[model samples]
Target: MTKSDPNRILRRLPLAVGGLGAVLLLINRLLTPELTESQARGDVVGVILSAVLILTGLIWQQVQPRSPDIVELIGEEGFVLAQDLPEAVKTELAWASHLLLTNTVTRSLIVYYQGKILLRRGILAAKAEVTPGPILKRVLETQKPIYLVALYVYPGRIEFDYLPENTQGVVCQPIGNQGVLILGANAPRSYTKQDEKWIAGIADKLAVTLQE
Candidate 1:
């Protein structure tokens, strides 16, 4: 489920209230409350307003959900690679990075291998160096990927200052036990389940390539 799932459910609040009002109004009509002519007019007005509320709730439910607002990142399009990498490994990294940037929602990518920056491509930050903080370190030790579907809510995002600033989402995919593939997206919660699986497969392939 997405981070906004709960918020979306909360939108039903208006419908719930409207439903309750309808029920109460139905019962009132059945009981046939004694009232003057003016009171009956007011009652009619209340019923009309209740119907409007129900209609509004139905329209709200049908409305499409909008993507989360994320500030655009400040950076330049660039590519960087570790000079010590073998030609084969360099070629593999370049191919993977290019595919991810062009095919996926990824706007910035970084491959940190064996304690060094192996590749940096797509929109790049000013600083070339990367320091793994709690989040990246945890992912490496656990050997499990961490998907920050929405980064603005997480304070740990600060550690990825080397990535394009204000990156909306991040995925830390571990390569074997020594490397982490960081993918930064332009919009929050844009990556789907299929995208995650594809990224994991890419990481597995990179781990083997780097080892060779």
Candidate 2:
């Protein structure tokens, strides 16, 4: 799932809750006319208050800045990792690569093991040996993902050495000790925190699968 999915759900939640409350209130007013004026007013007020609180909560949730949670975004089925390195595994990797490309502004995806390219998709300059530069090495050492919102904004960024021409942003994640996964895009700030979390989850799954 992309970032927009949750936002869409959140946007509709208030409407749904409010609609339900309104329907219940209308039914109560029509069917229970025998109730005292005070009781009817109390019921209407309770329904209105409930709907207002729910709408307010929805608005607050949308206003709050939240980093996309990977599990919440994709759930367990989306995190399925192949158990062995086979044709199926390659297919699965390609599927994941394509999924990321479709969801984000990614133009190129590369997976490298040691000094050799294992899988590559989209536009990229070919090289015999993919060298791990200083920044990449640091990511591998720390086993953390790195996001460069704008390649040009960082002078002498190591990613520029290996990334394709005109690549503007990148999100690189270390796939255990097996290799590294790099995603390249042409626009600055194309990848969000949610993308990082999603890719990290993928990297973790890939690491576990490769180790097994």
The parts of candidate 2 lying over 4 Å away from their true place are 1-85, 126-128
Alpha-carbon lDDT of model 1: 0.87
Q: For candidate 1, what is the TM-score?
A: 0.69
**Candidate 2 structure quality by residue, lDDT tens digits, 1-212:** 33355466666677677767778777877898488979878887968776896777577566744542211111111222233458766776877787777777777777765655667676655442467777778777887878888776777565445566567777889999767888877677767777788888887776776566
List model 1 lDDT by residue over 1-212, tens digit each: 23456556666767777788878877877788576787678668778877887887887787766766656677998988889878998899999998888777898999998899999998899988999999999999999999999988998989999988889999999999999999999889988898999899999999999888
Clashing pairs in 1: none
- The C-alpha stretches of model 1 lying farther than 4 A from their native spots are 1-65, 68-71
Could you tell me how far off, in angstroms, the CA of residue 174 lies in candidate 1 after the best superposition?
Answer: 0.4
lDDT of each: 0.87, 0.69
Error of 1 at 148 (Å): 0.9
Query: Pairing residues by index, what is the TM-score of model 2?
Result: 0.57
